[model samples]
Structure formats: structure tokens, C-alpha cells
Target: MLLDFGCGPGRVAGHAGRALGMRIIGVDASPDMLALAREEGTPGAEYHLVADGRVGGLADACADAAMCNHVLASLPDERTVLEVFTEIHRLLRPGAPFALLTTDPACAGIEYASLRVGEPGVSYGPGEAMPVRLRRTDGTWQSVRNHAWPVETFPPLLEGVGFTDVAQHHPTPDEAVGVADPEHVRSRDWSAERLRPPLVVTTAVKR
Candidate 1:
């Protein structure tokens, strides 16, 4: 079985469950998100609600693989981040893979030339937390407080929680940047700096 931590509206879980043809357990803190997941998710997926970053209802070592997407950024502090990591570790079988995706600390303040979002920017400093504001499709903005940690801080934190062989991946320009039309491409016009991604993806093994 696979576990989707902070599954939100089951966007990933629903697609993954259908594609992989496996049982997927999706857990999130928001009841509204859980409700949406249950309403829209594939048959292979199940939704659960968690409290205080704890998945207390799940059995120990129940999952073969786990994913936490866009979650670390929303954590209020390092303690909560550690708790979530620890809980993920506890839920995975030995040597199971855990994938994490979050806001990239490296490209905190980059302004995209092609992609458009309401005031798309990151606010942070070296060794400091990042706070971000993102605009939804509805044109409303949501604030993500304490959304990112220094890039240097992640390795040690994963190691402390008994994770090994951590690897980070940055999306390429074609993957990160969206093109409205195939024929009317202006990717070449974007500055090299704008190609720097705003998100980071990492994978680690539970030890």
C-alpha cells in the first residue's frame, strides 16, 4: 500500500491510485479536503483525517511507499515538520521510499517572466524561513506562513529521522514553465535566472 500524506483534494492520490492500480491511503488535516478526496477519488484510494500531524489510526509500517507534497511549507515550525517526518517514518516499512515536494528555498524571490500569478514571489533570507503568497485560479490570494526552510537544513533533519540516501531534484524549464500555445512559444525570451525553479522534490529511504 502507498500513503499520501497531506493528500489535500486527492489530486495526486486519485491519479496515482488509478495509474498504479494499488491501494492508496490519503491523509490530510482538513476535513473539507478529505471530503473532496472521498467524493472525487478513485476506487483504490481511501481518505483519512489527521490531527496534529499524527496518523494515529494507521498501523505501524503499513505502507510500502509514502509521499508528502507541498506540506512542509505549511508547517508552523521545525518541531511540527519533524513530527510529520517522524510519523511518515513510523508508517513506512523498512527501506521504504518517502518522496517530499515543497517550495524551493534557493529560488525564493525569482520573478517569472512568462508564467503569471498574482505577485508571484518568495520572501526569505539565508538560514531563515520563507513566507509565500500564491494566487488561486479564482484570482484570490492565499498566504503561506513559514512556508520554506533553508536548503541546508533539510539533510540533517532527514538524517535525524532515520532517513537515508536523500536526493533532491529540480524541475527543468520545460517542466516548470507553462506554455500557452505550442506554436507561439517564447521560452527563449525568458532570462536564464527565470528558469530557476520555485519548487523542490526530494526522495529518501526510511531506515
Candidate 2:
């Protein structure tokens, strides 16, 4: 089975279970998000609540693989981020792959089609507070306060928690050609995206 660590609203869990044909165990701390996930139930997927930083009734090394999507930026500090990573580490067996998706902390000021991080020409320190703006489909923008965790910090944290071969990559717009919507890729002028990619994918193996 695969674990969708911090699977808010089941977007990643449901899509992953459907696209990859894997049995998913989605765990989250929010009751409201869990309720939404249950409402939009994915086939061959189960939802659970994370209480006191632990997913209840789950055994260690039960998941073959896991993924966390953009969950770290919401955390207050590196210690809390490590705590979450450690929990995810416990769920996977030896050599299991953990793919983490996050916003690149350095990709601030640039306005992408969907989101913008921090203010223009401003840089944030590790675990520093910043304002993030996300563009909705209706052309509306939503502002949220988020913590910035630089890309460099993840490898050490992941390694400290028994994860090896940790690697981080900033994905450019060109890389999304095949997987993402063709129309979306074709329609937008992605100069800023090509120049400063906003998304980072960190991969590691449980050791």
C-alpha cells in the first residue's frame, strides 16, 4: 500500500490511487479535510486521522511508498517538519521511495499562472514567515501566510530520519510538457516559470 502523508482533502491520495492503481492510506490531522476526502472517496483507498502526530491503528513499515504534497510550508519550523518526515519514514519499509512536493522557497516575487510566493525582491530565511498568493481558477487571488523552508534544509532532515539518497529538483515549465495539461502549458507565457521554477520535488529512500 502507499501512504499519502498529510493528505488534505484527498486530492493527492485520490488522484494517485486512481492514476497509479495503488491502494492508498491517506492520513491527516484535520477532521474537516478528512470529511471531504471521505465524501470524495477514492477506490482502493482508506482515510484515517492523525492524532498526536501519529496515524492511529497503522503499523510501522506497512506502506511500500509514500508522497507528501506541499505540506511542509505550512509548518512553523524545521523541528516540526522533521517530526512529520520522521512519521512518514516510520510508515515505509526499507528502500521505499518517498516523493515530496513543495514550493521552492527561493522562487519568490515571480507570479506564475497559479501561485506567487512572498513579496517582490524579498527573500525569506529558513522557517520564516511570508505571505503567499494563490490564483484561483476564477481569476481570483487568495492570500495566505506560510513558512519558508529553503530547499537545502530538506536533505539533512530527511537523512537524519534514516532516509538516504535524498535529492531535490526544481521543475521547470518545459518539464511539465507531457504530464500537465497541454493547453495550460501552451496558453501561458512561461518566461518567469522557465527562469525561476516555483516547484520542487524531493525524493528519498527509506534506509
Candidate 3:
């Protein structure tokens, strides 16, 4: 089983459950999001509401592996980020892998397929408001503010919460071989993506 931390609307969590063929426990702080996830109904998946950064009904060290996708961007500061990690750590079994996916602050201003992060040549301080523009399906775009977390900020936090072997992977366009969707990869020019990845996945293990 896997725990999807800070799962919002269950888009990624649902897809992950189907692709990985594993039972996913999707938890979020928003009741509305959990309601939507339950309505969507992913096979072998469940949704729960997390309150005060705690997974209320879950026992300690119950989850096998856990992932947090695009969640740190919403947290305001390092203290809040650490609290979330600490709560997650309490639920993960020893040696369970924890994967955290976040938008790379370094890739700010680069226009990716689905979104464009921050402004060009604009430097955002830690936890400051980093503007992001996401492209809609209708070829329109919507703007939102996401908190900026430096790529280097995650390692010490993970290590502090009993996670070890921390590593960050910046996957480029050149590494897209055997991707599930080749057509999407060819939909746009990936040369810029090859130059710099707009996202980062940090992995660690509970110790």
C-alpha cells in the first residue's frame, strides 16, 4: 500500500494507483478534495482527511511507501514542511521509500508543456510567493502563487526526520524513452526541457 500525502482532487493519486496497481490511501487537508476523490472512485484506493498535519485514523508505521506530489509548494515555511515530514515519518514503516515531487525553483520562468514557473530572471526568497501560470486544455492559462522552496532545502529536512539515502533526480526530455505516452512527448519542442528540468523528485528511505 502507498500513502498519497496532500493529495488534492486525486488526479495524480488516481493515476498512480492505476499505473502502479497498488492500493493507495489518498489523504488531504481539504474535505472538498476528499469528497471529489471519493466521487471519482479509483480502484483499490481510499480517501481520508488529514487534520492539523496529522493522519487521524492511521496507526504509526502502517504505510509501506508514501509520496508527496507538489505539496511542499503550498507550505509557507521550513517549519511547516518539517511538521508534514514528521507526521509522514510516523506512518511509514522502516525502510519505506518516500518520494517528494516539487517544482524546481531554478526552472522559474521556463515555459513547460503544462505550466510556466515564476518570472524571468526573478529571484524568489525561501517561502516567498512564486507565481506560476498553468496552461489549460482550451489553450488558455491561469495564474497562481506557489511558495518557493530551494532544491537544496529538502535534503536536511528529510534527513532530520529519520530519512536516509536522500537524492534528487532532475529528469530531462532526453530520458523519456519508453514513456507511456510517446505522442505527448512529441507534441512540443523538448529541447528546452533537455536544457533544464522544471521539476524535481526527491527520494529517501525511513531509517
Candidate 4:
């Protein structure tokens, strides 16, 4: 089975299950996201809640691969990220692949200035604690707060956690198509010019 680590709304897992026929187990901290995923009726997918953003709930050596896409930045700390990686290491057999797709903060020039969301005075930024609410498939709402980390820090952290053959690939501008939001095309166009370099995709194996 493949683990859709930090699966949000099960979009990728659903696609993989239907198109690739992979048996998928999705784990996310958000119940709302999990409910939404389940409501999608994604065949061959199971959902699990990781309240602590760690994989202590999973059985050891139970998965062939794990995919974590755009989930790293939402985590709280390097230690937590490391713990999750180690847990993934424990759950996968030797040589199992861990494919991670995370944002390169440089790609967006993410500044940590205080910003408002939903409310007029609520503020959040990198290293700040904040709650995020997501709508579930069951029409319920769930909130979660995550710590953010930079892209450059991942390689050393992965290597420190007993993963080897680490490689980070930057998706070319052409490859970035279909990845951005349709409604945000104008925003992407402006940001594409501002941040011309590619974003990173890193993969490694448990050694």
C-alpha cells in the first residue's frame, strides 16, 4: 500500500487510486479534510487521523511508498518533521521510497510580515501560531495550526533521519502548468515573473 502522507482532501490519493490502481491510506491531521476525502468516495483509499502530525498510528513496514506533497510547510517544526520522517522510516521497509513535494519559499518570496485572514485583526506569519479552518465533506469544519520551514533545510534533515539517495528536483516553468490554480492564473502570471526559478521536489529512500 502507498501512504498519502498529509493528504489534503484526498485529491492526489483519489487520482492515484483511480488512475494507477494503487491501494492508498491517507493520513491527515484535519478531520474536515479526511471527511471531504471520504465523501469523494475515492475507491481504494482509507483515512486516518494524525492528531500530532506524526505516524505513530501506522504499522511498521506496512507501506511501499509515501507521498507528501505541499505538506511540509504546514508542519510546526524541524523536530516534528524529523519525527514524522523517522516514523515513516519505521513504517516502511528498507529501501522504501518517500517522495516529497514541498514549496521553495524562494519561489514565492514569502515574507513573514503579519497578515490578516477572515478577521480584521487576526495575524499570522512564519513561526507564528495560528489556526486554519477547513470545510469537510460532511459539511463540518476543522482547524489546525502548523509551523513553517524553509526548503533548503529539508535535505540535511532527511539525511539525518537515515534516508539516503536523496535528490531534489526543481520543476521547470513548463512543468509548473496544471499545478497552479485556474482562478489564480493572473496571480500566478505575476508571481511567475517575480519568481522565475523552479520549485523543488525532493525524494529519498530509507537506508
Candidate 5:
């Protein structure tokens, strides 16, 4: 089974289950998100609510792989990040793969069509904490605060949590850019530098 850690509204989980024909377990901290997932998920997609940094009701070593997407940067602190990592480590079978995707540290002040980079809420340096505002298709705005941890910070943490073979992957601008929608004002800009490696993806195996 595949576990989707911090799955919001079951988007990724549902897609993977339908597209790959995999059994998916989605876990998230929000009751509203879980409710939506249960209502609008794929045939083999199941959802669990996380409490106190734990995925309640799930047994240890229950999954073949786990995916965390856009979740770590939103964590309030490193302690929480480590706690989540430990929890993910606990849920995976031996040699199971753990994949993580988060904002790149290099995306601080760059401008993109869908997102506008704002001033750092905590510090002005790359790999520092900052606030970003996202523009929706309907012209609504959502603000998010994220920690831009250096790419180097991931492997050691994964290793500490009994994960091995940690490797980092960077996507090129062509692979990273989203398709532009003429109807949406916030559609992606194919020419923006922010489209270049806006995310960092890491994969490791549970030991």
C-alpha cells in the first residue's frame, strides 16, 4: 500500500490510486480535508486523520512507500519536522521508499505567474523563513508562511530517522512549469525563472 503523508483533500492520493491502481492511504491533520477526501476520493483511496503529530489507527510498517508533498515547509519548527519524519519512518516497511517534495530554498524573491514572493517574515536570506501569496484562478489570494530550509538539511534528517540512500532530485524548468490557462489570470508563466527548480524532491529508503 502507498501512504500519502499530509495529504490535503486527497488530491495526490486519489490521482495515484486511480492512475496507478494502487491502494492508497491518505493522512492529514485537517478534519475538513479528510471529510472532503472521503467524499471525493478514488475507489481505493482511504483517509485517516492525524492527531498530535501522529497518524491515528495505522499500524507500524504498514506501507510499501510514503509520499510527503508541500508539507514540511509549513511546519512551524524543526522539531515538528523531525517528529513527522519519525512518524513516517515508523509507518514504512523495511527498505520502503519515502519521497518528499518541498519548496526550493532558491525560490525566495523570484516572481511567478501564480505566486508572488513576499518579503521574508523572519529573515532576508535564502533558506530562511518567508511568506508567499498565491493567486487563485478566481483572483482570490491565499498567503502561506514557509521555512526555506537548505537542500543540505534533508539527508541528515532522513538518516537520523533510519532512512538510507537519500538522494536529491531537481526538476528542470521544462519539467517544472505548469500549463498556462488563458481563462485564468494566475496561470503559469513559461518564461519565469521561478519556474526553474521551484521545488526540491528527495527520496530515501527506510532501513
Candidate 6:
């Protein structure tokens, strides 16, 4: 079985299920996202709420693999990452794969990297929330807050949680990939910088 851990809205889970034809399960912390998953997910997909970033609810060695995409960067705390790793290790059989895709803020644009955390807001999950002022080239400001992690620390943390054989995929500089349509091109143009290199993809074995 494949556990799509931190599957938001089940979009990727559905696609991955179709592509791999594997028994799939999904987990998420957001009720709204999970509700959408229930409404739109593939017929056989199973889903459950993570509640507190703990996965004790799942049976041991119940999954063959776990995939966490685009959700690591938003986890509420560092311990939550550890918890997820522990949970994944527990849920998967020996030598099962745990894959993750996460944002590396160090690859952020100069403007984005320069922004300061303005008196960070309430703590959530594994970390605190901080307001960021996006510095626009036109001298205008845009405000948003995102969960941040220091890129240099992830490997050790993953290792600490009983993951081994960890491998990271780094961004390739300007690799040409086809855009199927105009909308796709537009979306790429808008998000490319933020989505490019420094977005780390990692895979580890539960050993």
C-alpha cells in the first residue's frame, strides 16, 4: 500500500493512484482539505486526519511506501517533521521508501530571502508563524506568512527519526521541459522562481 502522507485535497494522490495502480491511503491535518479529498478522491482511496502530526492511529507496517509532497515546508513544527518520519517508519514495512518534496527557502529569490519575520504570530504545529513583506520590484509590498525551515538541518533530523539511505534531488539550472498549454505556461511563469531549485526532493528507507 502507498500512503500519501500530507496529501492535500487528494489531487496528487488520485493521480499517483491512477498511475501506479496501488492501494492508496491519504493523511492530512487540514479538515477542509481532507473533506475535499473525500469528495473527489479515487474510489478506493482511504484517508484519515493526522490530528496532531502523530500517526499512532495507523497500524504498524501497514504501508509499503509513503509520499509527502509539498507539505513538509508547512508543517507546524520541527518536531512534527520528526513525528511524521517516526510515523512513516512505523507504518511502513522494513526497507519501505519514504519520499518527500519540500521547499528550501535558501533558494528563494533575493527579495524573498531578504524579508524579515515581523514579530512572528502565534505558534502552530512545529513552529511559529511569521509575517513577511514581499518586496516587489515596483516598490509595492505584498504580505504573507509561511512556515519556514532552515535548509541545512533537514538531513540530520531525518536521520534522527530512523530514516536511512537518504538522498536529495537538487534543482537543475534551466532544464527545458514542455508546457502542454498556455495555462500551464502561465502557471509556470508565475510560480517558477518559487518552485525551482532549492525545492528539495528526498527519499529514504525505513531501516
Candidate No. with top TM-score: 2
- TM of each candidate vs. truth: 0.79, 0.95, 0.95, 0.71, 0.84, 0.73
The TM-score of candidate 5 is 0.84
Sort order, TM-score high to low: 2, 3, 5, 1, 6, 4
Q: Rank the candidates by lDDT, best first.
A: 2, 3, 5, 1, 6, 4
lDDT of 6 by residue, 45-134 (tens): 888888666654678899998898867656667777788887778888989998887655554332333243333333233344544465
How many residue pairs clash per model?
A: 0, 0, 0, 4, 0, 5
Give the lowest summed-lDDT range of ten residues in model 3: 172-181
State the displacement of the C-alpha of residue 177, model 5, in Å, after optimal TM-score superposition: 9.3
Q: How close is candidate 1 to the true structure, as a TM-score?
A: 0.79
- How do the residues 1-207 of candidate 4 rate in per-residue lDDT, one tens digit apiece? 888888889888888766556888898888899999898887767888886646546788888888888676566666778877877777778888998875444433232112112223443344444444444546566655544455567789889989999998876545545755555443334444334442467899988
For candidate 6, give the lDDT of residue 159.
85
Tens-digit per-residue lDDT, 149-189, candidate 1: 65566778888999999988775556533423444344345
RMSD to the native, candidate 2?
Answer: 1.2
Q: After aligning candidate 1 to the native by TM-score, how far in Å is the CA of 171 from where it should be?
A: 1.6
lDDT of model 4 at residue 206? Answer: 88
lDDT for every model? 0.74, 0.89, 0.88, 0.68, 0.78, 0.70
List candidate 6 stretches off by more than 4 Å: 110-143, 172-196
Best by lDDT: 2
lDDT of 4 at 130: 45
Instruction: Give me the runs in candidate 5 sitting further than 4 Å from their true place.
Output: 117-128, 139-141, 176-189, 193-195
Model 2, 32-53: lDDT tens digits are: 9999988887887888898877
Q: Any residue pairs clashing in model 2, and if so which?
A: none
Residue runs of model 4 more than 4 Å from their true location after superposition? 108-148, 176-195
By the lDDT metric, which is better: model 2 or model 6? 2
